[model samples]
Target: MKLDESLFTVPGVRRGLRFYVTGPTPCPYLPDQFERKAFTHLSQAAPDALHHQLSEAGFRRSQSVAYRPACPNCNACRSVRVDAQSFSPSRNQLRVLSRNSDLIRRPVEPRATREQYRLLKHYLVNRHEGGGMSDMGFREYAGMVNETPVQTALFEYRQGPEEDSPLVAVSLTDILRDGFSMVYTFFDTRQPKRSLGTYMILDHIRNAESYGLPHVYLGYWIKQSPKMAYKKRFQPLEVLDGPVWRRLEEDE
Candidate 1:
């Protein structure tokens, strides 16, 4: 596909930064549709600041690259963030927290470990079978965790406070100026009742509140995708509409 030079003119984007559009590919979230993306590399010139600016403008970081959907005929993907300061857990969410209260969360450097890869492998096989990341090997997994120009961390969740407890869940997160961006999260699929996925997000909300951050970027949310439906459960969700963010009402 031809590079879209017009995207370089976006405000806050530094001069000389090039942007390119990807050729159309099958859309993962929708049926009988294709998707494309506008992406640029986060070079050393000003990686952190550039990442923050692009993130606020609805781009997501994947390793050292920032990208946003540029589908020609569809705008189904909407960037969503949670208002952490004003967020209140509902009864169900509270229960999810209580259920996994014993799990200990530790913020570690963005380094890949054998345990994490093992958990990721299990998660892919059981939860995301045949998906894009299902067949990822250790080298690629390491790149996902370690190849970042912006500030990033891995929040590892273990069953207990003991130093040797087995890891139960992990979230690869980006530390943004305004909030934390949940780049990706995977958990032990054996314990469905524990609701580790929801718990990880809930923990991030509390973590953001403790850090005095106002928002928690949850990446793209497509209303028609069942896989993305869980994102809406967080109340007072804000979605990027054009250049502005609008709150999603409960009735909508």
Candidate 2:
């Protein structure tokens, strides 16, 4: 796969590798603001070190591209990661874990399955109706799960250890040199009591700590978005302050 030669014809081919910017789209996390993304393609030719660098620089991988918020007017969308070494689950989080003790987590290759897609559709219908991914078809979902240029994995949660236990949640995760980047996660929305979303994050934080990893990237944490506020719950959180990873103070 050659670099997109036409990209060099564009005015801002400034990076050693080509970078492209997406047109403005309505901000899904904020009101009355448009969002743009500056992204570069990820290729098998040399992506491992580049992927690690880009992630540390606040870029997120989606399929074959690594991108970050390029919105001209807003900087509220900060990339955040949980400090796995210093993290301590709050009482509520402990309760959530206790409630989900029956659910067994399984790690598998990043291959999309019909069962996962169906559960995702059900979750979207109940939890994120009309959101961007509400209409994702199986083909699109498969591409999302399988078209990675770097190492990736899927974590599935089920009811019990039995091979046929009901599948309840799935997380698409990117394996980084130092931590895990949670690309996306969806669960059975019907079981509100389960708090599956938080459970998955807790599980990741624990797993990363156990494996000697120090961070668990949680993507953009928009200050004004209630939906994104949850990312901050796993303290002590670190926000990408330009090139530095600093402690995001509590009550901030």
Candidate 3:
């Protein structure tokens, strides 16, 4: 059966079609202000052309949902991507890379696991207990891991005896034709010294380079948000400005 493309509507002022905006909710990145999002759905039948158009137009996808910036009076969130080949880790990043040298990485078909959910719950409780995903039930976690219409995988990082290594971290990523986008990542928060978060970004850079991909989308980078500020640390990055990605200087 053919999918109805008409059900897919582009919301914009020029089209005179109002994009539905959600009610004001506490901003997740910022401290107190409310945030609203304008979003559109992406059907399984949605072609690659439409997906590319939406992504280039500044929309982000998580699971099966695609959302764009529609802040009524704010535009703080900026979409950022890194030129994978040009990204060079700093001294601290190199230290992190060296620390995780023992762990092995493998990309597998995305799937939900009981152990993964447990780790995810611990990560949220210890690291982001008050955040939006803290209360996500196992089923919701499964949806997050398994719901996808594109090439996706979970990069698992494990340590020790090969057969008995624990799943220390997992990154959900979408493999685009030209680049890769990190949809989400979770790790054992107890291993603070390992700096698994930084390790994952570095690993993605290496992964992109090895696969001959040019860029790695790091999602939105909010300079004011501590949680997001780490993104800027990956020097020689490009920020999506208007319709183009502008590279930043060393001093920037």
Most TM-score-accurate candidate: 1
Task: Please give, for residues 137-246, the per-residue lDDT of candidate 3 as tens digits.
Answer: 99999998898776788988999637458999999988777778888999998889999999999999988999899878888887778878788888778887776679
- The runs of at least 3 residues in candidate 1 whose Cα sits more than 4 Å from the true structure, single-residue gaps closed, are 1-8
lDDT of 2 by residue, 1-252 (tens): 223333233232225677787889999988899888878888846687778878888889999999887776678889999999899999999999999999989999999999999999998898889999899999999999999989899999999898678999999999898999999999988899999999999999999999999999999998889988788789899998876789998788
lDDT agreement with native, every candidate = 0.91, 0.87, 0.78
- Kindly report which residue stretches of model 3 are placed more than 4 angstroms away from their true locations once superposed: 1-19, 46-49, 161-164, 249-252
Q: How many residue pairs clash per model?
A: 0, 0, 0
- Model 1 C-alpha lDDT versus the unseen true structure: 0.91
lDDT by residue for model 1 (1-252), tens: 444444456677677778888888899999999989999999668799999999988999999999998876778899999999999999999999999999999989999999999999999999889999999999999999999999999999998887679999999999999999999999999999999999999999999999999999999999899999999999879998877888987765
Comparing candidate 1 with candidate 3, which one achieves the higher lDDT?
1
My TM-score estimates for the predictions, one after another, are 0.96, 0.93, 0.88
